[model samples]
Target: MESCGMSFIKYLLFIFNLFFAMSGLGIIIAGALVLADVSDFSHFVTSDLVGPPIVLIVMGAIIFLVASLGCYGAIRENYKMLVAFAVFLIIIFIVEFAVGITAAVYKADFQETLKKSMKKSLEQYESSSNNNIEKAAWDNVQQKVKCCGVNGKSDWSSTPMSCCYKDKMDESDQPEEFCVSGGRNYIYKEGCYKRLQMKIESNTKILIGVGIGIAFVQVVGMFLAFWLAYTIKKEDESK
Candidate 1:
């Protein structure tokens, strides 16, 4: 009955590790996609913004490798490999915990940092020219987010065509004069910074939650691998 129980745990650990391996692969693919898309808007993204995708790629690769170790160690009942897998998992958990704590502690600063970077980008916006990625990014944000300038309409000496109200737009494909006209009230009053900051916070919370959940699962897998290996070792000694 003890041997049977050990075998069951060994299989369970293998399944857990297998699932984690697949999840790691998915993260790697998602990070690669993010990196590729961000490259197109490189001028708009700050160094801080670039770090997440690269970290994701590295963490995913490491998780995949450690999961393989766990799976093989469990299946083969290798005591040394199981111990190594547990040790690696503990290290990863510690690192992830530290990161989470640091992020939480510095969460307020993230908004300020993002706001400064965004304001810098907005100060450089040129509506007549779409030749640069920064201008293109701002145009897209203004058009899609339905917000004008970094703070409000007053930030712009002349409103960009993107901020013009849809109803007042002329049939001409060229830039509308209504956006710049002092008599017109077609410009959006809200700032893009608040909208962007909200989005960033929401995404950050989701990623942190996912990271914590993954780390918890790794901890469970570590215990299961260690237990299974210990059980196998004891059984061998009795024989």
Candidate 2:
């Protein structure tokens, strides 16, 4: 009977360690995906800054080590090893909280920057390009401008200055240039990139969901590892 109990405990410990180690790996991969956001910074007040990605990598290392220790400790019935694993879990919990808070603060800053960019874009439209110049004369205005995926080259090809929406007016209060190409309505304005804003919003929500799920998984793993460690010791005593 004692031998059976020991074997059962050992099996539980092994399963727990295996699942958690793989979970940690998944979290690490997700963190790498978040790091990829560095490529797009048009809407950020602060850059990707390297801090969060580095923290995530470090967390992955901790989780891997702790999970390994839990497995080894359970197999060997080593109390010291179990304690070490618990310590690692505590440290990881603290670090996760800190990183999460920092990200929230940064997100607020980015939102402010996005709002400012939109206002700047509106101002630029009012001050420049009254839409009166011929396509040839206004090539420069149209060149730097993109609305709904239409550029100056296509804008010139259209008749009666068909490149723009009449709703977008200039400082003189006349209808400004708009484009209906690319299956979306758009007004050409400086300092505004809605694509970047949309990207930030979408990514932020995804990251938040992923973060919560990872934290929950980690916590559950920690408790299960601790319990399994105890079970292993109890079996050894019975034997």
Q: State every prediction's TM-score relative to the real structure.
A: 0.79, 0.59
lDDT of 1 by residue, 22-107 (tens): 97897787667666544433445567666767787888899999999988998888889988998998898888788778777877
Candidate 1 runs further than 4 Å off: 29-45, 126-133, 165-186
Compose the digit string of candidate 2's lDDT tens values, residues 1-239. Answer: 53665567656766777776776787678667766663334222334534555566567766777788877876776766876776677778777778789878887675666556544543343345563322232333233232221222232223223234445444455354445755434454432234455656666676677667767766766675567667756756777
Q: Highest lDDT, which number?
A: 1
TM-score of 2: 0.59
Model 2 stretches with alpha carbons more than 4 Å out: 1-3, 42-50, 113-193, 232-239
In candidate 2, which residue pairs clash?
164-178, 165-178
lDDT of each: 0.74, 0.57
Cα displacement (angstroms), candidate 1, residue 216, comes to: 2.1
